[model samples]
Each structure stands twice: as C-alpha cells, then as structure tokens.
Target chain A: GAGVSQSPRYKVAKRGQDVALRCDPISGHVSLFWYQQALGQGPEFLTYFQNEAQLDKSGLPSDRFFAERPEGSVSTLKIQRTQQEDSAVYLCASSLSFTGGPLEQYFGPGTRLTVT
Target chain B: QQPVQSPQAVILREGEDAVINCSSSKALYSVHWYRQKHGEAPVFLMILLKGGEQKGHDKISASFNEKKQQSSLYLTASQLSCSGTYFCGTEMDSSYKLIFGSGTRLLVRP
Candidate 1:
C-alpha cells in the first residue's frame, strides 16, 4: 500500500561522476515515469516505462541518461558523467491507467541530486 | 512540445478564489493538474479529458476547452493548504507520457 518510493533521498556528486537513482513504484502499478525538476521550474519528462519495456524515452536530455526497468516493477535511472546542469530533483511517479481521464500520477518525495 | 502556464506566481488570502491556466500550441487529448509544495512531492489535483469529462474534488475543479487547446484549474475558497506550485501536464497523444508546463506558483496566506 505504499506510494512510489525512490532511494538516496539526497545525493551530492562531483561533475563528471556517474549517478544511479532507484525507483520502486506502487505494487502492481503498470506505468512508471521519471522527471527532472530544475530550480524554479516545473518537472520535465525524462522517460516512461510500461512494465519492463520502455515505450518512450524521447524526453531524455542526452546520451548520459539511461533507464531500465528490468523486472517490470523496480526501475533505475542512470546518469553517466553528470554535469553541473544535472543538479536537480529527480522525481518518480506511477499511475494506474496508461491513457485518458484517469491519468493521475502518484509521485514520490524525489531524490535531490546536487552536482558540484 | 511543453505547454505554457500563465501568471508565473500569485499571492492570495485565505477564502479567496484563484484560477490557473494552461495553454498549448498543439492539439491536446487530455490535461492533468498537480500541486507541489516546497520540498514535497507533487500531488494529483485533477484531470480533464478531451470529450468534456472532468475529474477533481468539488473545491478544486478544472475545465478543458478542446477547441482552443487550453485548460483552467479553478480553486474556489482557497485555503492555506492550497499554497503550492501548480503544474499542468498535457498529453497530446495516446501515450501515457506527459509534457508538463513551466508551472504556476500559488501562495495563500491566512
């Protein structure tokens, strides 16, 4: 009955370091999403997963961003060789339906990644 | 493309009403609204579908004008609890992914 959960609530990484963020969606949730929130701005979509297969990833900023949902429940978003611009809050969300009116998402507290 | 939200920020007193608007250049299939307080997760507020179906609590309702590619979230008799940054996520296609707007910051004081 827990909502979406992300590990490493806070992270400090040096520029050019690689960081991996984890997300555990609600039990049996079919849809999962990743977003990046910069200071004073809204969240920007990074990627989406339906079960273990990632259907859309066009929102990923660059090649440094990679995500996988191997088991269809737990997902990991890896940022390779991070940059100072990568400093932001990474939020994970889950929803019940894939499309239409009930597309409400349940979000986690988010992992704040500070790149120095 | 990302949607656009108006009134970058607003300050209101308790019991007042506020409206947040989201407009998109592309034809939208649905619009979703959410609220996020400082240092907190974004909570779902409501969803407006293409064909006139709307979902939300009575106090917080949203309307979608399909023809104009716009949606408005109306918060009547606002409460301090309503103080937060409001975001509108737009779905242009059948995919579940949402392209979120820049967001509208709303502050309510007692």
Candidate 2:
C-alpha cells in the first residue's frame, strides 16, 4: 500500500499570495493530520481530521490558515495572504485508526512553501 | 504545551550509546519517537503508552513514565545511519493531538 503523499513538493509564493497544499492519505485511513515545521525545529500540529469532520484545529496559527477534507480521503490546507513567517515545510500524516489511542502515523514527504 | 527535550544536540561515535529525554508540563497519555534526516520525511521509531511500558526494536528503545509526564529514548551501539534530528511527540489525555519537542540533533561518526 502507498504511504501518505503531498503535492507541490516545493512552492514559492510572494507575500499576500494564497496557496493551497494537497494531501493524499493512505487508503482506508480514518485520521489525517497537518503539521508545520520551521527550519531546525520539530513539526507543530496544525489541524486534524477524522473522516470528513475536522476534529481539531486549535493549532492553526491564525485565521489565514484554513483546512478541509470534504470526502474523508484527500485533504487540503490553504493559507490566505501568505506572510514571510509562513515559510516552512508542511507535513501530512495519516493513521489507520481514530480510537483516541496511540496509533502509528505515516508521514508524507512534505511541501516546502517559501513566502517571499 | 509543547514538550521540552534535553541536550539539544549530541555527538556519538559508532558503537556508542546515547539517550534523549522529553518532558511535558501537562499530563500525558502517550509518547512517540521519530527520526528525520535532512531533506526527508520523519520516520516513526516507537510509541510508548502511559503504562510505562518500554518498547524497542534493533538498538533503539523508549520508556514512558506516566507520573512524571516524561519519556526517554535510548539508542544503543549507534551507527552512522542513526544521525538525524530526533523528536518526541507527546499526546495529552484524550486530546488525540501530538505536541512535539524542539528536537535533539544526533550525529554519529564512524
């Protein structure tokens, strides 16, 4: 089976631009997650989805960041009016279960977004 | 809150051993360990549940202490392939979200 995958492996956007990153999770995965990793730092949680419902999104830095997973399979993270501080590697992960217990998550290669 | 990892970085020689620790301020339900090489996605290493079970494979192992809200990752007989940034993700009780540590950079030389 294929692991989690993200599109637009690299993107360069000018300040104030809007960019959408796509994530294709593993087949039959019930949980999807988005994270942001700054240079030399660990990944920080951004949002999580269970099926088609967004279960948690408190980690989003601001209103400019939005995410959706309408069909419970593929998900998208949109950043409106990108700022220089938004430049980072965006990672997507998926898990087979949503039991609120400890489950292994497989990660994607990530999308490196540079807001210049 | 995000967990704090000790010894921001460590250098090791092949066949040596090293330990990385993560401490969280909040009550934790589980802890996860991962290693990420440059220009690559993070690879999962191990997960330690609240019961204080120690899990491992190969030369890597981890221990979780529920009472202290802390976890430790042990890498024994290190190899050059173990060089990478190690991160510990802590999950609070019923939160289902993982808050990661700053990371511990490990360098192994032959």
Candidate 3:
C-alpha cells in the first residue's frame, strides 16, 4: 500500500484473552508511533519507535502491553489478559524523521480492538 | 493537560465561514491540525511552528499565538467537502508524542 497499513481492522476478544495488532508504516519512514483512542476521546500516546529501536514505552498503559519493531519495518502491539477497558482504536503513524521538533505524520486506518 | 477545543460542533452553510479554536493550559511547542471523516484516519492539514505565523491551504488558514498557548483554524468560503471532525494535536518541546484534542465536528449544509 502507498500509505500506512494495519492488520485486523477490527478485533473482538474476550476478557483475559490476548490480542496482537500489527502496523506496516510508510516505507523508509524512520519514526513510528502508537496511540490508543477510547470512545468519544482523542488518541493517547502508547509508544514510540525510532527506526528499529524502541525509544520510549512510557505511555504503555500496563505491563500487559508490549511492542516490538525488529527490523524498522513492521511493528506489533500485543496485549495480554485483555479487559473491557482495553477496548479502543489503536492507531499507528510514521514520520520521515525524528530530530526535528515536529514532523508530518502519516496515519493508518487504525485497528479497532474490542475487549468484552 | 489536553487542549480544549471550543464550539464542540458547528454547522455551516455552503460558502460560509467557520472558526475553530484550541487552547492549552500549559506552554506548547507546536500545533498540528488534521481533519477526519466519519470512519477514516485523521489526515494532516497544516502545522504551525512559530508564533504569529499563518499558513493557508486554499481558503483554509490557521494561526498560532505562542503567548496565549492557543491556535485557531479558519475556513473561509467553506464547501460541502469541508464537513468533518477537526482535531488539534499539540506537542511540548517537540516531543515525539502528540496529544490530540477531543475534536470539533463540522457539518456543512448545502
């Protein structure tokens, strides 16, 4: 795809189940970011990756949340023991660079995860 | 703190104008504007880096006031295609993370 691509556009998982969301950012983009958006709310930062390195994970809601980008191309966000509160739209975005104060970020369609 | 967007929603007639404002309680580094339709990803519209600088696309323009920690988006001579939810994303000190506002839904009536 020409733009950012995400897998499993919609997922419904039972409580205590595990789920993984995948994101394929724009090719050659160096910066990737994950955000979680609850119903009727704006997206909140969850993690950030600069190339293959996980620069920051401070925004992860809990230990159950994990993300990895092994080769600076595709990234995955895994959530274990899902809870009702875990339901939200997971969004992935990528920018051309990270050093500048602000870079235009291209966003994916986002994966809607519903934990029931 | 999350930026506050005023006029939670607005309704406009074709060829009209609308203004959406976003304000932050804390200092800000930059402001980004994006528009999202009913069920799609937010698309980048414009970015304001310097205070008092205004950038425009067609009839859409935006201004940033560094001292007030606020930014406003102006849509002049609006068209039907302009109807959508507008969100203001802010960054502090150029942090990698962008905090987006709740959003303001705009409805354009023909």
Candidate 4:
C-alpha cells in the first residue's frame, strides 16, 4: 500500500475475550506507534516501536495490552481479557525517521474495537 | 501529560478565520498538527520543531512557542473542506511518543 494500512476495520468482542489488531506501515518506514482514541477525544499513545525493537511501551494502560513488530514492517496489538473501557478506535502510525526525532507520522484507517 | 486544547468546538463560514490552541505543562521537543474527519484516520498537517518557527501550506498555518510550551493552528479563509477535528500531538524532550490533546472540532459552513 502507498500508506499505512490496518486490518479488520471493525472488531466486536465480548468482555473477557481477546482481540488482535494488525498494522502494516509504509514500506521502509522504521518507526511505528499504537494509540487508542475514545469518543470525541484525541489519540492516546499506547506503545512505540523502532524497527524490530520495542523501545517504549510506557503508554500501555495495563499488562494485558501487548504489541510487537517482529519484522520491523508489520505490527500487532493484542488485548487480553477485554473490558468495556477497552472499546475505542485503535490507531496505527508510522514515521520514516529511525532516530526517534521529530517527523510527520502517517496514520492508518484505524480498527474500531467495540467491547460489550 | 496530555496537552490542553481550547474552544472545544467552533463554527465558521466560508472565508472566515479560526485559531486553535494547544498548551502543555511540560517542556516540548516538537509539536505536530493533524486533522481527522468522521470515520477516517488523522491526516498530518505540519510539524514545528524549533521555537518561534511558523510554517504553513495554502491557507492553513501553525506556530510553536517552545518557551511557553504552546502551539497554535491557524485556518484562514476557511472552506467547507476544512471542517474536521484538529489535534495537536506533543513530544517531550526525553521521549519519542506523542501525547495528543483532547482536540478542537471545527465546522465550516458554506
């Protein structure tokens, strides 16, 4: 794809169920980020990855949330034992800068996760 | 900490102007601006890295004040296409992750 792409644009999961969202960043991009956005709010950072290294996960709300980029191109966000509060749009963004410097990020369509 | 944005919502007519502000409590390394419409992902508008630097494309522009840890987005001669939710993402000097503001909703009526 010419830009960032996410799979399963919409996912509905029952409480206590688990879900995984995938993100495929633009080719050759080195930095990927995951964010959660609630209704009428801005995106909150969840995690950050530089290439294949998971450098920062401080924004993750709890231990149940996990993310990985095994190949440095594609990334996945997994939430275990989902709760109602987990319902939100999960956004994926990628930047070409590898130094963790300032750069414009390209965002995906985002996967809307609905937990009931 | 999350940045704070003013004017939760605004309505503007064609050719009008609007300004959205984002303020943070901590020192920042950079500030980024993005716009997201209903059911769509955020589109990057511009990024300000240095203090007192102003940049713009077309009728939209932005300014960053590193000392006060604030940034403002300017929309001049607004068009219907400019109607959307605007967000400011802030990055601290010690981290690479972006902490975004609550957002400013702008409506442009023609």
Candidate 5:
C-alpha cells in the first residue's frame, strides 16, 4: 500500500460489546504505534510495537484495552466491554525504524469508534 | 504526560503570522510538529532533534530548545490553507514513545 491503512473507517458498538480494529502498517515498517483521540483532544499513545515484540503499553488506560501485532505487519486493537467513554478515534501510525533519530511517521485515516 | 500548549486557539487573518508554543515537564530529546485538517489524519510537518536547530517547510518553521523543553511552531504569512489544528509531539529522554500535546487550533480568515 502507498501508506498506512486502517480498517472499518467507522464503527459503532453497543456498550459491553467487543470490537476489533485492524491496522496494516507500511510494508516493512519496523515500528507501529496505536493512539486514541477523544473529541477535541490530541491523539494519546496507547501502545508501541517493534516488529512482533510489544515494547510499551503503559498508556493503555485499563485492562479492557488490548493490542497485538503477531505477524509484525498487521496489528489489531481489541476493546472488551466497550463503554461510552471508549468512543474515540483510534489512530495507527508506522515508522520505518525505531532508532533514536528523526523517524518519519505515516498515519492512517483512523477508525472512529463509537460505543453507545 | 501531555505537553503544555499555549493559546488553546488562535484566529489569524491571511498574510498575518502566529506562533504556537509547546512545553514539556520532562527533558525532551526531540519535538515533532504535525498539522491536521478536519476529517483528516495528522500530516507530518517537521522534527527538531536535541540540538537547537530550526527546520522550515515552506513558510512553516519550528524551533526547539533542548534545555528548556520547549518548541514553537512559526507560521509566516499565514494562509487559509494553514487553517487547522496543530500538534506538538514530544519524545522525552526517558522514553521512546512520542507524547502529544492538547493541540492548538488555528483559523485563518480572509
């Protein structure tokens, strides 16, 4: 693909329902990141991946939030028992490398998740 | 932690200039600027490394001060196309994750 891609541009889930958002990073991108953005707010980092390894997830608000990048190419963010507060735009970004330098990040359109 | 962005919002007339500031509590290794228009993802603007360097993209320029943990985005001769939300992402010395600020919304009127 030309750029980072995310599935289900918009998703509406009832409270308590589980929803999964998929992200396909740029091919061969070594770093993948997931962020949550509430209305009128900036995107907040949720998790990061270096290849197939999950490096940091301290930003996950609660145990209900989970993310995985088993194949290192595609990632999925699953929310269990979604609450109305969970309604936000989930953004996915990928960088070519994670070294401590100026790494350009390409972002996806983002999935607007709405929990009723 | 969320970086502090000053002047939550600003309205500018075409050909005018505006400055958006971002400051972080933690020591910053780098500061990244991004602009997002309505219904779109954030577009990368520029990145300032640890050193005191200024990078410019067209009329948009940014300066980072590693010591003060501060950075400012400078919009010269602002245009209507520059109307959007600007964000500053900070990478602290302690972590590799990029934490973004609340954002500054800019509206350019003709």
Candidate 6:
C-alpha cells in the first residue's frame, strides 16, 4: 500500500480522442517520472518532475502528450488526439533523492493504453 | 540514446550464476537496474552511481565503470523469482531522466 499507485489499469481510446492517466507517487518523493513502454521494449522516458517543477520534458514524443504534477505528489498524463502509435503501457516512477545513493525509483503497475 | 544490453534472452537453472551488462555510447552518470514480470510494474533491482555507493539486494551485485561508460549486473545464484525481463536505465544528464534499453529476458528455471 505504500508504493506508487496508478489509476485505470487499462484504457481504450479512439482515434482523435483524448485520455488522461493518473499517477500517485510514493509519499515524500521529490522526483517523479513518466515513461512509455511498448509491448516488448523497455520503458522510454516521457517527462520528469522534481517537486512541482517539470525539469525535463524533452522526452515527450509530441506536443499532444502533456504531463503535470500539480502539487508535486499526484501527476497526470494527458494525451490529446490519440493515435495508434500512442498505444503503450504508461509507467510512473518516484524517487526520494536525486543527488545519489539509493537512486532507484519505485514504479507503479502502469496503465496499458490501447488506441484503436 | 538508449543503452545496449547483451544476450537479449537467457535461460538459467536455479543456483546458477548470470551477468547482465549495460553499455552506453555516451558518458554515463549512473545506471539503474530493474526487473519487470508479465503484466506488472518494474521493480527496482539496484542503482550504481559514478563515484560509488552501489545499492542492491543480497545475491545481487552491480558495478559502474565511469571510464567505460557502462554497468554490469551480477546475479549470483539465480532463483525462480528472478525470472523476468531485466532493464538497464542509463542516466547521462543530471535531470534524472533515464533512457532504458530494450530489456533482456531472463528465465530462471527451478
């Protein structure tokens, strides 16, 4: 119960439709990350949030993909005009420190999005 | 760029040993290892920093060679629970964004 939690374990979206996925990081985590995983490939970075500030978003595939960590604890990833290429497993991870040591981030079960 | 992982998949018997290597073209600041089972989230396995301070569970060891810009994960005495796809996340920038490689599927047979 103390680990990261993601809502809507699965989602189905139509072309040109929009969908929002939510992620709740571990309590007191300072760093949050969003990643997209294809069927058999490893997760690819999408965006990152250090507290409420989104430090890096260069990994975002396109402007249609938007993510925000409003209060720095809960984050949401919204995809506008969903495309078949957007179909993938969305993962959320959180870490306590960024300086070093136990730098590992905890990941949620992830939401599998199917854009048909 | 995403790091390259070797031996796309491997089969091991329980109690056997295995090593997973992650190599990056660019200088690596750190390497994070994780394992993901079918239909599950990736669980953190270990973290190796550039300087030192390698964090991992018992029977699992990792080393980060800053000069080589790579990391190696050593799995000592494999177990059934160790059966999963292993991923190596490489950090080149200070922003904490990790570029993960195509996972290596590892099956530990009992």
Q: Which candidate is the best by DockQ?
A: 4
Error of 4 at B48 (Å): 0.6
Candidate 3: misplaced stretches above 4 Å? none
lDDT of 2: 0.94
Per-candidate interface DockQ score: 0.75, 0.78, 0.77, 0.81, 0.67, 0.75
Candidate 6 residue spans exceeding 4 A from truth: A99-102, B52-56
Q: TM-score of each candidate? A: 0.96, 0.97, 0.97, 0.97, 0.96, 0.94
Steric clashes per prediction: 0, 0, 0, 0, 0, 0
What interface Cα RMSD is found for model 6?
Answer: 1.5
> Chain B TM-score of all predictions, in order?
0.95, 0.97, 0.97, 0.96, 0.95, 0.94
Tens digit of per-residue lDDT, candidate 1, span A1-116? 89899989999999999999999999988899999999888889999998898988988999999999999999999999999999999999998866444578899999999999
Q: What docking class should model 4 receive?
A: high
Residue B95's lDDT in candidate 6: 65
For candidate 4, lDDT tens digit of each residue in A1-116? 59999989999999999999999999999899999999999999999999999998988999999999998889999999999999999999999886746888999999999999
Q: What C-alpha lDDT, on a 0 to 100 scale, does residue B41 get in candidate 6?
A: 94
lDDT of 4 by residue, B3-22 (tens): 99988999999999999999
Off by over 4 Å in 4: none
Give stretches of model 2 more than 4 Å off: none
Worst 10 residues of 3 chain A by lDDT: A36-45
Ranking by DockQ: 4, 2, 3, 6, 1, 5
Compared with the true structure, all predictions reach lDDT values of 0.91, 0.94, 0.92, 0.93, 0.92, 0.90
Give a tens-digit lDDT track for model 3, residues B1-110.
89999889999999999999999998888899999886688899999985678899898999999889999999999999999999999988777678899999999999
Off by over 4 Å in 1: A99-102, B54-56
| TM-score, candidate 2, chain B alone | 0.97
Q: lDDT per residue, candidate 1, B21-85, as tens digits?
A: 99999999889899999999999887788876555686898889888899999999999988999
| Residue B52, model 3, lDDT | 70
